[model samples]
Target: MQGPPITIRLLLLMLTSVALMTVDHRQNHLDTIRAGLSLVVYPLQYLVDLPSAIAHWASDNLSARTTLVEENQQLHARQLLLEVRLQKLYALEAENARLRELLNSASKVGEQVLIGELLAVDQDPFRRRVLINKGSDDGVFEGQPLLDAYGVLGQVVEVTPFTSSALLITDPSHAIPVQVNRNGLRAIALGTGEAERLEIPHIPNNADIQVGDLLITSGLGRRFPPGYPVATITEFEKDPSQPYARVVAEPAAHLERSREVLLVSRTAEEPSP
Candidate 1:
């Protein structure tokens, strides 16, 4: 016998809930159970609210203009540090390249060269000369050829016991015999009394010279080392009426800014002991 109808089941469920509630209230039997359940849920409630606390702290930190300024200053300092290191690397690379060229020049000349340090540049506007820290005491003599890492610069003209003066190839009174590196057409390169320019005064209008010819020492005067660079032709002009071409060149040496030079004692340029 299926004992109860649907309505009867529902009526019985209501009466049992009411009787349980009345008993719990009279005896306080459920109080410990409710407290135990509250304790278990407290940690979850705190966890759900943690996001708001973190957001409030971050907002306060970002609101201050002073904090942004401090961060920008730190970034600038780091950038400057890197730039300074880059400059040092550039200097080291230039120095290494200059040393390599000096070694090559020394090998090609096949002479004993004494290193000369610049003491002072000549102040006279009419002369292109410099004083070096080598003299008779260092075996330096007049007409001794001076060169830098690049090429022939000048010859020592006056010497003291401890110092000497070199007249640059750009001096008005200086001249060197040179030949075209490509064809060996000989000419005399005369200084223009300027620090940057030289001239070949008597070049034939139809000479084998070109605008970009290299002029190395021709060993004609024997004052400069043969095969050493003297200048580079930059311009060649010929007038129909004139018999010669006006050839101008730039000095191969760093005439305006050399800090060091080599004093080569070739057989013909050196003074006898």
Candidate 2:
């Protein structure tokens, strides 16, 4: 009662398929019947493929959204980076302009001049001083003249190994000899502890000075070189009680805003015997 041998059964089925194919080829058998069967099974075939179609659609939509989101984030980051670089470029342009002016002004000294950057500013009320980066190590010494792009800034009063302190012309204790650029009238310019004011202690009533006169270093002290600008005569008034004329001058240097300064390497000298 066992089934026929496997090889024999396979051979029999193959022969039957061949016979059916020969008959169908000759007589067009099963043509109408096959059409009817396909019609009946078409709905089932479509039903089986629906899940795959929906899954493919969901996957494609999710992938596109994720890609768009990633691209948007990358674009935003790139824009921010470019903005930061542009700001830095603008700042550099302004700084370069300032440096060019400083170099041009230093040329007036006509002596060996060293450039120094500001380090710190004192907040003390009594002493108005600033520290520069160069010091004794850089050939800076006491009484070394400091100049900005506009005019004389200050003079180095103290020097350390790597830094030096400068006393601005606006300090109360500082004094410089100045002369009117128009007339040879010499006078002492004294700091008034004010940023914009310097007081000339005693100007004779008959002195040939007027508003708008440019003040230049007289070089009498031998501490500063000759022909450097100091301040401008802004006001002059006469008081009946006071013997000296009241005069106020504004500093030529941008004392509060100077970031870089030049130090004249000229040595301070004394009159020879």
Best by TM-score: 2
After superposing candidate 1 on the true structure, give the runs of residues whose Cα lies further than 4 Å from its correct spot.
1-96, 268-273
Alpha-carbon TM-score of each model against the true structure: 0.65, 0.72
What TM-score quantifies how close candidate 1 is to the native fold?
A: 0.65
lDDT of 1 by residue, 1-273 (tens): 898999999999999989989999999889999999999999998899889988987888777667888889999999999999999999888867776777777777788888887899988888889999999999998999999988889999999999999999999999989999999999999988898999899888888888889999997866776898999999999887999889999999988877778899867555443
Deviation from truth (RMSD, Å), model 2 = 6.9
Candidate 1 lDDT:
0.88
Residue 108's lDDT in candidate 1: 76
Q: For candidate 2, write residues 1-273 as lDDT tens digits.
A: 999999999999999999999999899997999999999999999999999999999999999999999999999999999999999999899888889999998776677799999999999887789999998989998998899998888899999999999999999999999999998789999998888889987897767889999999998888777788999999999887878899999999999988989998873344311
Off-target runs (Cα >4 Å) in candidate 2 are: 1-73, 267-273
Enumerate residue pairs that collide in model 1. Answer: none
Error of 2 at 84 (Å): 2.6
